[model samples]
Target chain A: MEKHRSAPTLDDVAKMADVSTATVSRCLNSPDRVVEATRKRVLTAIETLGYTPNFAARVMAVKRSFTIGAIIPTMENAIFARGLQSFQEELHQRGYTLLVSSSAYKPEIEEEQIRTLIARGADGLLLIGHDRDPKIYDFLSQRKIPALVAWSYLPDSKLPSIGFDNRAAMFDLASHVIGLGHTQIGVISGLVDGNDRARLRVQGIRDAVSSSGLEAGNLTLVETSYEIENGAKAFRDLMNADPPPTAILCGNDVLAAGALRQAQEMGLDVPGHVSITGFDDIELARIVSPALTTVHVPHREMGRKAALQLVEMVENQTAGTGEQLSTRIVNRPSLGKPALG
Target chain B: MEKHRSAPTLDDVAKMADVSTATVSRCLNSPDRVVEATRKRVLTAIETLGYTPNFAARVMAVKRSFTIGAIIPTMENAIFARGLQSFQEELHQRGYTLLVSSSAYKPEIEEEQIRTLIARGADGLLLIGHDRDPKIYDFLSQRKIPALVAWSYLPDSKLPSIGFDNRAAMFDLASHVIGLGHTQIGVISGLVDGNDRARLRVQGIRDAVSSSGLEAGNLTLVETSYEIENGAKAFRDLMNADPPPTAILCGNDVLAAGALRQAQEMGLDVPGHVSITGFDDIELARIVSPALTTVHVPHREMGRKAALQLVEMVENQTAGTGEQLSTRIVNRPSLGKPALG
Candidate 1:
């Protein structure tokens, strides 16, 4: 093994290249400003000395990291993956790097991660929703850190967000199912507390029920965490009730996939005996048997938009403004007219 | 909106609390080292002023961040999610934070991320697979930044790894399938050019074929990326061959799921018309109809072990040692005796 040497610094590179420390810094940060011959000398010296511009020292100098941090609810599923990929790609195109952490859908953990990112000198943050404690917002304000919310949109939210209207999207899907003559319906929702998206989705179902001249209170609602196993269990329990529903609506694609699998296991013929609808057309929606009818949220587009909007806020120090994307229903094999008649 | 004010500094906190700056730092970092009364006074002053200790200054002082960075291939799948969650949990228990970035399976992007993470003062890094530019290893060695590779193990690699033997695991799965009297087999492998895991897996199948008294070179193989749609296309092409395979083995569960879905779409019965097997018993394996007969890697265990080993390296300046975990073949309904006449 080679003998250990202390990590190189800017001054060492300057001394080796016989140039001022500022010239070495310019070569590293903005090479275009340096003359080509001198730049080659500085770069060659940097390579020989193995010098990495200390990010901490640079952060101290410019008060900017050019790095953005994002804290999402979960990484267990691909629901957030596409959008985040686009977000990172866009940020990269504009000379920014992204670091991400999973909060596991816990608000306190999310807040702690936010503070950790801020303390690490993240130029800005991208949050998932707008349901965190007000104190957390106040802290971000006091620290003058800009953050943009994604995955759910609110016109009057405390934090500017770039996403779709979850409530309206779900409502439109529900009304379409009802328009197909599904009167007796069951809903499997994700946990609603601190999840504005889930809560809004449930409310949308109720809105559809009321508009279709049905008793909204009569809807069979099962609240569970977002997991495939949970979705299967909820589906089984819902079917056990007296006069089981003809159609089942789930909060997202994962749950809908579980319901589809369990339905097959129970020897139930999809759309022939019952129908199912899912939200968020992740790949899971199509991979399962009897492909799911779902609301297609433009995840990639939302991600790209969020990145563009977030960079605007970070560079300009202007708070992000809300932008609502649109979603449409994708009618696949899983949905059909109820067989009640 | 409130007007912005200059951010509070360490001097301001010391002046407000009427204590030395070092005392204020002790109160924030090591409260047990200070008197309770004085600690309370300093904390109160900090709260009143809402001071956030600048992370750059602190890094400059101690030369450590207590933050670890992991760069993996993709977050678009759950293959890395479960293991990464456990990795993060273990790091948190040891008073460390984890930040992750995806390399999208590109060597240049991965090297860029590794450099960026190191420059950001990450105490250590976790990488995937042992295949990379040798210069990267030299760079890391010169910088003395500890790193551990996961998901594939090599006994004499440049970096220590904590993972299972991919070639052996896939060989076992293939031999089991062959034992079911499957002479005609088709393989849907991930692109093997730069990925050792995929290359080793393909080699494992070839090993099993030769050991079974079959011509390994004659085995039908289709190469594609790890996407469901690609798997479906590969499976279709394989089935369209002159002599259709009695069994189809996939690189991983994602590919297996796609093959199964496409099989159903083509109106072929699983385990009867064609047996299919997968590697990596991810959630996709169980969720897919017929369930996947595959190799079950100790993902969570590997993650926990990697964390423990990497932290030891970072703290003690000790070089990492390779640890190999085992994998087992999980027999599910997807595999059965070949149906060739």
Candidate 2:
């Protein structure tokens, strides 16, 4: 085996430049503090020696990683992809690297990831949704680690949240469907046990149905994982009920797209036979047939805000206690008047 | 201003535990080398002090970061999301943290990210494809960083790539379309300049068309970015031809999904007025109406292999030269016999 090599260190560069170690460190850490001639000599020595400042050492001195860690539920779909891309870009512009990890929708995994990021010395953290064990929050607080939540917003939440109002956003979209004379509504929702976003969105639809003078029992609900096939299966089962719904409202575009395709496969004409709606108006909503009517969360804006807020907290040690974003409905062709009784 | 707190060091833990500094370091770095009784006492002191190991100091001492870095083109869609998720999981299982950065399809940004990862002392790197400048290879070689390429496979490429054959996979799918007697085919390809996989896939389709005695010029081609909106606009342009092709082939399912929806909106029956096929066979392909017929790349397998190869190269200092995975066509409901002339 070839002999192992060592990386050039600050001491080597300082020795090569014939400067005090403090001068070399100051040149690298705060060039403005060093004389131009001395800084030039230090830089040349650094370049010639190929001395790269160890990130951990630099982070230790500055008390910042210039890194932000985000933990989300999953990345198997495009739901969070667009927003996250924007988030990362924003961080890049702010001179930070975005480190992301998926929790596979498990709270335990998310907790573990939080600990890992902290261990890795992330200056700030971006969490998805405002739901987690209180112990996690206490741990973060005790450690003084700045954390921001995205994807769903709660004004009453303790953490700084940069996301849309899930319940109100869904309620607005569902009201439109209810106004279209859809009394019988079947719902295909993402499993919501640990996801406040999914749960709140489902409740928003239920509230809309009840407020429209329809009995709560008139609405049928099927809970499934966030997969297109699962959505299709749930839609098929819902249609087999004694009284099929005139419209199907899904928790998100992924499920809505699936239900729409499954309805087409079953020979049902959308809107003409059954209307379908979704939330989070991802690209799929517009790319699907008839174009889905859904709530358009300002995903890019949310991402940008989350990145900025987290960075601010990390850099300035400013407490990020409360921040909220808004959401609205995007009325597309998928929702229309229900077929006559 | 709030009082600033500092992370506890090995010396701090040693002072608190009434143990030698070497003993504290050994207790944290190589607990087995220390007496069990002393190790327990040191660990308890560390826990009480809330002392997490300094990652940088550990890297300097052990020459290991236990971290891997990956740089990809984009994260705005499911393009690299699923495969990357699997790759990160594999890294986690092996006790490593995966740090990912997106270059937005720019080579310069990718180079910057590579240098950043190296500066951060990443043990290994996972790159998207084999299109970077030779200087990058030199930098990795100089640093002795074990790097692996993914998403596209080239049997004789200089890099060790754990990906599927993009060209042959698309060729097989194109041959299936040709066998269906579709004389004229419209191609919606991703911008292929910096993307070897997209370029090769397009070449494969052209090869199949030429070999089948079909005039390659008769195949209409529209190059666009990988976006649903671009796919819709491209489909519109293709359909407006004096003699629109009887079939449309898209570089990926996101594009194909857009084309299918546009065709439906234009009141044309898919596989009736025109057949549509996609690549990558992502979940969207199966979820879309008509079920896109496309090539299935072994995404998870490739991800796992890439992780394993990179880890091996890092841990065992093994040199990985070249490797390739297989791809196959998935015959779904989208493709059917061309409409009778």
Candidate 3:
């Protein structure tokens, strides 16, 4: 308590370590810029003095918080966890702190969080998708707060993004499933009202069906929230239809896992009775029995690139460009040819 | 843009909504306190005027941000996701927003994040585990910041916690395994250097071994970071021992998943060639084939209770008490009697 009453400053640390205050600042922000010996001496002095940099005062002077905010759709699953972890690692390497919030797939909640983050002085933001009200874009531009969208990419979008084309990736997988001679198809889709990624994925399946000369209107579709139980329920609904679909494609791996579990409970052999596939090839894809055939997304790369680009925009005040990543199909055991009639 | 030339104030909102300024404030903070019709009128007026509540000014006026911060060990897995989601939900219901940061299981990073969150004006903190430095507790107390620990419970602790007893729970599971007539056992544990939960879990196994009149030192043990790949590597190491144990017990479900994957890769039949068990019966436990025999923790209950208690501490300025939740062993196909030699 007595020690904090007279808080040590950068000057005190410099004097104690016999270095300039600039060097001390460098050590704190970018240790690699300073000599190792000098860095160690400054750090030792800092520990001995119990000095904590006054972050609020720093923000006041530099007009930068060195903080980034990310508002994800949900935190209940591992869908965004892997990418967010990589994004945070890159942010930390560049001496930035990350604060995250989950909106539970509600646009109103997301807008509120965005405003909250901006009010809290975040220099930049990492948003998930590009399916928000244009008024939000206007507000962000008005405030000059740099924000980047991730997870779904658009080639000619007004907003910059660092992700793959959801539609194309899903289309490729759907075409492959159709090539296996499965005329009847079912889709377990995420609710698409406010989520462009889910909407695009479902459209991709439709595109493939129409191109393959199948009656697109004959497709079985069940839209629900992104929970495992919801996925199982949707799968049952699709299967109960007259002339049930031979192949089922899920919006993501979590839903596919649920569908697979329900199939097991119903005493059906995967890829024998019906084929199953999923998107967003998360770790759960391989962990489950009859590993899911899915699309492999470069989640870590997208995260790293988003961090670098968002930081660049914040520092340089530039309008960044979109970079589209590629996705590929992973032909695992979950998807196979339908049984002969 | 023209509207931004003059910002809307509380008086403007009151006049437009035909209510007192206090009513407008109540509508924003505690909608339940206002009549439904009045609240709807205020909300409509707010939307029409594009009036965003001045969060910064409110913070300065009340000396409270109404934002709760949570720091978890890692975000790369689902270990903390379920509980944290519940915590955030409860906070939202109480008109508070949650900001989360991941420490990557590093003590120094956790310390830095703790300071960052406090500096950002969090009204309270929700910390995972109770194994940080004593100086941190001193700092929080000096600042009058209310912090509650979750995920591991301890009685008579200076700090309050809401979680299950890790040591006792693991002890019960180990005793169950030993009772199945397994003379030899292998343990795969998370690193225990600075983590009280991991240390207590390992100690639990030791207690079970000693109580059963077995040679505790003869038990094969491998310690590593909490990752599925690391778990697989540790399992292989344990199996390479001169006399491989019939059953392997993993510290957590993620590690157990890795061990199970490695077993499949080695063409070893689960519960036929080797029995495997895991702690933390998360969703993965059920998703994996030959479901894990593990301990079931009431994660949602713990999260909800922690949020309630932490908010009480912050609002009323009272010292909180530790409340322990109970865990039970889940019997599944992964555990069975050892095969005769």
| Top-TM-score candidate index | 3
Q: Candidate 3 at residue A134, lDDT? A: 89
Across residues B41-87, which tens digit of lDDT does each residue of candidate 1 receive? 89888878888776765564445566789998898878898899889
Better of 1 and 3 by lDDT: 3
Task: Show where candidate 2 strays beyond 4 Å.
Answer: A1-53, A60-63, B1-49, B57-63, B240-243, B336-341
Residue B71: error of model 1 in Å? 0.6
- Model 1 earns a TM-score of 0.90
Which 10 consecutive residues of model 3 chain B have the lowest summed lDDT?
Answer: B54-63
The alpha-carbon RMSD over the true interface for every model, in angstroms, is 1.4, 2.3, 2.0
lDDT of each: 0.87, 0.82, 0.87
TM-score of each: 0.90, 0.85, 0.94
Q: Write the per-residue lDDT of candidate 3 for residues A1-341, one digit (tens) a residue.
A: 44545777878898999998777766765566788999999999988887766555446445677779999999888999999999999998887889999999999779878877776668899999889998898888867889999998987765799999899899999999999999999999999999999999999999999999999766899999998898889988988988988999999999999999999988889999999999988899999899999999999999999999998998898998868998999999999999998
Across B116-143, the per-residue lDDT of candidate 2 in tens digits comes to 6776667899998888788678778877
Question: Model 3: clashing residue pairs?
Answer: none
Instruction: Compose the digit string of candidate 2's lDDT tens values, residues A43-85.
Output: 8998798776666555644656566788888878888887898
What are the clashing pairs of model 2?
A: none
Clashing pairs in 1: none
The candidate, 1 or 2, that scores higher on TM-score is 1
DockQ-superior candidate, 1 or 2? 1
